[model samples]
Target chain A: MSDSLNFSYTVDGENFASAGQASVQVKKELRQLGIAPETIRRVSIAMYEGEINMVIHAGGGVAQVNVDDSGIEIVLKDEGPGIANIEQAMQEGFSTAPDNVRSLGFGAGMGLPNMKRYTDEMHIDSTVGVGTTITMKVNY
Target chain B: MTINDIKNYLDAEVLCGEEFLEKEVFSACGSDMMSDVLAYVKDQAVLLTGLMNTQVIRTAEMMDMICVVFIRNKKPNEEIIELARESGIAVLTSSKRMYEACGILYSSGLCGKAE
Candidate 1:
């Protein structure tokens, strides 16, 4: 495909069980497009982490995926309470998530790090009490 | 090892995806934390966890895992099992504890390293 393909979805903030739906759909779409399995997996993991973050931290957000010949780009924008310390948040075991979140098997403070681990590029923009936007890319 | 072998090793019951028992898995990871499972990369892996929730299935899907084995006799609810069924991931429940289950699988050659 010479032209880029774009997909967008509104991530639900409530109901943690409903999270990761968009990532699942995107994974299927990438498969139908015949993207490499490894590439598709990387994209799915990064986007899934971002989606879970939006639901757990931001109370929901917008997730957009742009697939092109060179790579895939994922944008996650959430209007939840922004991160107070990006550096600390990026740490492997630093989490601000409440006890309830940990009980559900998330909030181990690995979301942002995992996103960065699987993607080729990652950028985080945030302001306290405002919102956070994360952009990540995975090259073919 | 195939999913069937994992079932036999743990003496687990197949909760769903019975048709997929023959599918092969190269690696395995045992964790209750879904995020920790997502943090690592494993090819054609089996996830062993006591966590019973929809996110378990979702995490397995995101990682493209072939099967999920619930440890400590932990049984998932209908919603979670249905999610795994829809994703084509095998689900199994074993009476073995997490450590013992992982030990059995690991000793049988299911290393955690990605192939």
Candidate 2:
């Protein structure tokens, strides 16, 4: 909140139409901040995937982004049926989303993997029935 | 190829961004799954998908894509067109199926990741 630029948004669960609103806002802000195209692209894609995941799985959550001199950090928190197996879930093509979500052009089991791939650092913390918190960072 | 060329190639209809026909795109891909597109796409300027939804435009926005071609002559609703318009992306609809559409674009020199 001080020198570091911070932005936050509340993601609505199962709201497919508005899922990427936060990511879009972040992209615009990053562009206005004059962040490099490559960095902005990575951050936006990763953040968008996380936002979609929040809607599909956790029913909605919170997204927070912090931009500093070193890099950018994205934190996503959702209170849903948490990932039962982090190891299996990390594997590409493994998804817990229902078929209805797949019909909407997502739930390909690539969201988490794609998020990890686009970020320099990623961590996932989850519980059986509580929720999940994912932290991702991309260094400048 | 430019968005104009795609219109001529597939005999497609421009649903939005008709004024931006001269836009140039280097690569393209066709998929209904937005996740797959987001996961594997890199520098692909055109998205050929049958999926008609706001997320289609949102995905293109995230990827910085210039055009979205709806395969099989699938028409997007007014809201979808508005999203594409606001996102500054050209939207087109082609009668060609996904396989044929991709093939036509590929043979016309719009290479995918294989290139």
Candidate 3:
């Protein structure tokens, strides 16, 4: 933990065009660290999905990534309308995103599922009317 | 096959990463929904889609895709092309529709499975 690298970014929900910036940067950083391509891909894809979800559903949020000897951990925190049903939201085709968001090539209801699929470990903490925090990890 | 092979097969015009036309790609997938691309894709080297947006390029980048062919001749803007260029991913635009373009490539021996 002491020698771990920490990176954080404020995801801008207002700009859909820039939603995946954090994930891109993280990917570059991971690559520079000489992480395995598969591990980096898993971490970046999971984080990218989380970033898009924050922009589309939570009106933006904060993303934090910590890389240590054991693995990489990503935390996405947002203060928006929290998910009412986490299980239902996790379904492959379940989505609450608007039609316009779909027009941008997402909103097929695969965000959370994809995140869960890529990461070695994933956890979602949410309260209706409050906010949501998701934690995901990829082993090194 | 190489990116050049895809370019010739689909009659696509290279928009960027011309230097990478020699890059080899073992598999391909065609889709408009990026989430599906993200979910089902496993080491697919080339992506064929009609969707036009920076997210398309971003999705390819996340999946570590090597080439993106925009079917229906959907020309992405300068920003989208630049993003692909930055990621060292080849960009191609073709007049063929998604189904036909995919068929041509599939018949050319490109499967959805990674080599």
Ranking by TM-score: 1, 3, 2
For B3-103, candidate 3 gives per-residue lDDT tens digits of 99999999999999999988889888899999989886567489999999999999999999989999998999999999998998899999999889999
Question: How does model 1 fare in lDDT?
Answer: 0.94
How far out, in Å, is residue A25 in model 1?
A: 0.7
Which regions of candidate 2 fall more than 4 Å away from where they truly are? B113-115
CA shift of A45, model 2, Å: 0.8
TM-score of candidate 2 to 2 decimals: 0.97
**What proportion of true contacts does candidate 2 retain?**
0.88
Best by the lDDT measure: 1
Weakest ten-residue segment in model 3 chain A by summed lDDT: A1-10
TM-score of chain A of 2: 0.97
Write one digit per residue (lDDT tens) for candidate 2, span A1-140: 23899999999886799999999999999999999988999999999999999998899999999999889999999998899999899899998889998999999899999999899999999997999999999988
Regions of candidate 3 where Cα sits further than 4 Å from its true position: none
- Distance from true location, Cα of B30 in model 3, Å: 0.4
Tell me the tens digit of each residue's lDDT in model 1 across B1-115. 8999999999999999999999999999899899999998889999999888899999999999989999989899999999999999999999999999999999999888877
Candidate 2 chain A: worst 10 consecutive residues by lDDT? Answer: A1-10
Interface RMSD of each: 0.6, 0.5, 0.5
Compose the digit string of candidate 1's lDDT tens values, residues A1-140: 79999999999999899999999999999999999999999999999989999999999999999999899999999999999999999999889888899988999999999999999999999999999999999998
